[model samples]
Target: MASTVVVIGGGYGGISVAKALDDIADVVLVEPRETFVHNVAALRAAVDPDWTERIFIPYDGLLTRGTVLRDSAVRVRPTAVELRSGTRIVADYIVLATGTRSPYPAKLDVEQAADGAAKLRATRAELARADRVLLLGAGPVGLEFAGEIKSAWPDKAVTVVDPAADLVSGRFPDEFRAELRRQLGELGVELVLGTSLRELPGTDPGRTGGFTVTTGSGVEITADIWFPCYGAAIDTDYLGPELRPARRADGRITVTTDLRLPGQHTVFAVGDVTALPELKMARAAQAHAQVVAENIRTLLQGGGTLASYRPEEDAIVLPLGPKGGVTYASEVGVLGAGPSADLKGGLFLDMYLELLGAVVAR
Candidate 1:
């Protein structure tokens, strides 16, 4: 009999690993959301609701030979996973891929997945009525949000404020950063780098409304609304005392080179749940899938040797809305624009969904 591989969380990494091992093992994917939200396109969906419909991929058609459970894992032991619904699943190997969470609109919730796409579409009406926008945090999420806003509504005032002295500091080369600044300037996005916010004078900090935000530089920028694009809270509350002493500095579970917990080969972790020093993006999750899948295969085949996962030092890609963006690799940068953005950046969400056998409209 083939070994049962239970994969927790239905994010990019979980789904990819399950799909790859569907033919070789009895794969069980545990997730609470009825539909998997393509988080990569969540920012774009926030800017344009029409894009939201394509952001969610239902798991019903995902695996031809595997099974998907519409429940969340509350406790994960070495050989089994206890569901929140009091159900239990015994497995030969357990792959934990429970990713991080952000704010509501930024990251869709499980309940929101029901009609979250529709909610994003409805938000289009709200975003269109607003004239000025305030985005806190100059990280990739904030930068992508700004890019999406500029692409959808160029006339709207978009200001990105960050406490960091430099935008995308040290991650991208100097010339790449300059190019990013140039693009932001051409798109009419006001970059307010190296600044702190005193407070927001808006009534609805979550919703778009006429508001004024004061900065540490004594300049107040007024906007219709502001969004928080900083800080990521990882979802690792399920792992009990069985694996507590192996967390890295980033609050992520520490894993070995083979993506397995040290001294716990039966238990593996991937995606944002791991303590790797790589960017916690969907693309990185995909890369993690390839490594984790091979290790699982080796373990299932009697464990000759496990493969190690080495994350690329400089693998970064910023999709600036639907028209253009940038990609950085190994100290070199490439500007992705026009068809390139639509082909790779835009459809990346769709492509992965399709690869997972989800219903994705071209």
Candidate 2:
């Protein structure tokens, strides 16, 4: 009998591994949503509500030989997964790829894609009506969101507040940070760093209203629209008690050198669910999927030396809207606008479609 591989969560990592092993094994992918949420374009989608539908790619075109279960995995054991519908599936190898969740409109709280689209449309309307926008976090999400708003509405006052004292990541070179600052200045964005908020705004994010909050530095900031842009909760509550210790202090699962759960070689974890030393980005997660896929393929072929995963030290590519952004890699120290745009502009949509084996209509 062929080895049955069951993969959970059809996000970037899950889908990538499943696609890699589709022809080699009986792959079963358990995912809740009917569509793959392309989180890379989420900020841009928020600014342009019409583009919301494009961010959600149907899972229908993903794997030709694999079966996708449009259901959530409520509990996962060493050898099987129990669905919320109470159905249990036994597999020879199980992959835990349930990623993390971020604040909307970067991520959707709704499980259904249609509902998610509706929420983005509503938020876009709110953004369109508001003249002043405040983003409460200076991480990639917050900075990119501020740029998105500025790109959509040039005159809108945008302020980014973060306790951290820097704009670009400190790990990157000074040239990278300098370029980031120049881009933000061109967009007319005011960044309030090294200062903590005394109290959070009473108004909910994405809602149009006047609100003022004082910073620890004795500066008062006000805006009509505000959003909380940082905070990612890993999705691992579905794992059984046996895997509890596998969950680390940082909320990510500890995987072996080969990306398998320690002691349980048949079970593996990937994406934001794993305690990878690297930054948790879709790019890194997909790389994890590649490594996991190779290991699983070896297991299916009856044992071979599994390849270990080593994260790239400075693999950070952030694109703010289609035109502006920054990128950093050791091979090429701190790339400029052209490189950033080339790396992560509208190309994401095309790349995903190709990955799904779908051809776009010209």
Lowest summed lDDT window (length 10), candidate 2: 353-362
Candidate models: Cα lDDT each: 0.80, 0.86
Worst 10 residues of 1 by lDDT: 331-340
List ranges where model 1 is wrong by over 4 Å: 248-250, 336-345
Kindly report which residue stretches of model 2 are placed more than 4 angstroms away from their true locations once superposed: 168-170, 359-362
Question: 226 in model 2: Cα distance from truth in Å?
Answer: 0.7
lDDT of candidate 1 over 159-207, digit per residue (tens): 9999998777445677667767777888899988788889755565446
Best lDDT among the predictions, by candidate number: 2
lDDT of 1 at 66: 91
